[model samples]
Target chain A: MARAATTSDVFNAVAEPRRREILTLLVVGELEVGAIVTALRLDQPSVSKHLRVLRETGLVHMRRNGRHKLYRTNAPALQPVHEWVSTFERYWSNQLSRIKERAEAKMKQSRETGTSEKES
Target chain B: MARAATTSDVFNAVAEPRRREILTLLVVGELEVGAIVTALRLDQPSVSKHLRVLRETGLVHMRRNGRHKLYRTNAPALQPVHEWVSTFERYWSNQLSRIKERAEAKMKQSRETGTSEKES
Candidate 1:
């Protein structure tokens, strides 16, 4: 019998910053190996290795278009990750929202003070 | 100068399934070391090790409450992880939504067809 998929596999594959950057690049659109290599400024083999891990974890999809293999983000594989992170969103979201609100308030205050200062 | 925080450190710490589960448990409320270890059903040393990694990554906070150490999820530490994952959300989100739709549609279809045979 086949083993059930685990979240560890997905998280581990995505933990590498380089791999995350590659995924981000692919998010914009599909790209060939060369495009990714040039954009990331990483060794071709290293890029290939990260891609292999992502592909293995089902987080990425690749297709052969003539000679080059084009890679794209595989979204379904990422659902578990989102779900896992979302569990704590209720706890953290409020804090982030508050921080944002404070920053915006500060900016507004600064703008108002600037106008008054200029008038003075 | 201090080194900038790396996403790898955050992602790698969360990548461990046990550690993730611990975070989930802590999300509800603060818990002591004993409670976490018992809930996880792992060796004391193993739980300690996981907690150490979590604390080092800034993903968790601990305080001494009387005789025991209470642990809680540090929401700020997780923001970077969330941002990193959100980058690829657009690409994968649609695919997952489609799969969910298909699954729901199939279930609805089966319900509509009362004559359908049950699977073994």
Candidate 2:
């Protein structure tokens, strides 16, 4: 029995620049396989391979529309990726405050040292 | 000369679960090499290798303090990863609206077909 792709697979799938570009293209609107190949200027086999990886990652989904398979971004699976990256938000937000405090404390120490030297 | 790690490298580096755990650990405060090894319960060599990869990826930094090398998360390097992942934000927000519209349209479509069948 085969299980559906898990969220962790998405992290590695998106590591490639070309795959990310492919995802960006799909975000605009649904397109057929031929259209993706032409737009990205990639060879058919390469584009197909990337699309397969993206599909397996569950970041994109496609459906048969007449003779064409229309593909579009499946944004829900990206939730795990977003959540994992957001974990670092706390560190990013606090960085500014930490830098400011360090600078101010250094200034205060310098001023106090000068005063003590003058007194001596 | 080898180039320093770029933002893309950080994406690949943090893709590993253990690496992400290491980053999470550093978020609280700085820790010395020995402390990180003990806290994670990983061997010194394994932790050292992970630290090297983290440093090369620019996601972590170390400064020599006496005999110990203090390590901490370099939050700024994570900026690019954050920004990249955020591009999907528009898609995520729009998904809810799209799903609602689809559901409503399906209901309306079913009612219209039912009415037409009754007329026929």
**DockQ scores of all models, one per candidate:** 0.29, 0.26
Error of 2 at A34 (Å): 1.8
DockQ for candidate 2, C-alpha atoms: 0.26
Please, what are the lDDT tens digits per residue for candidate 2 over residues A1-117?
A: 222223347877776677888888998889999999999899999888888988988888999999989999887777787888788886887778878887777778778775322
Clashing residue pairs in candidate 1 (N, C-alpha, C atoms within 3 angstroms): A75-B92
Measured by lDDT, the strongest candidate is 1
Looking at candidate 1 chain B, the ten consecutive residues that score lowest on lDDT are B1-10
lDDT of 2 at B59: 86
Stretches of model 2 off by over 4 angstroms after superposition: A1-8, A96-120, B1-8, B94-120
Could you estimate the TM-score for every candidate? Answer: 0.73, 0.72
lDDT of 1: 0.79
Question: What CA RMSD would you report for each candidate?
Answer: 10.5, 10.0
lDDT of 1 by residue, B1-120 (tens): 222233238887887778889988887889999999899898888888888988988888999999999999887688887777776676655677878887777788788885455453
Which candidate should be chosen as best, given TM-score against the real structure?
Answer: 1
- Tell me the TM-score for chain B of model 1: 0.69
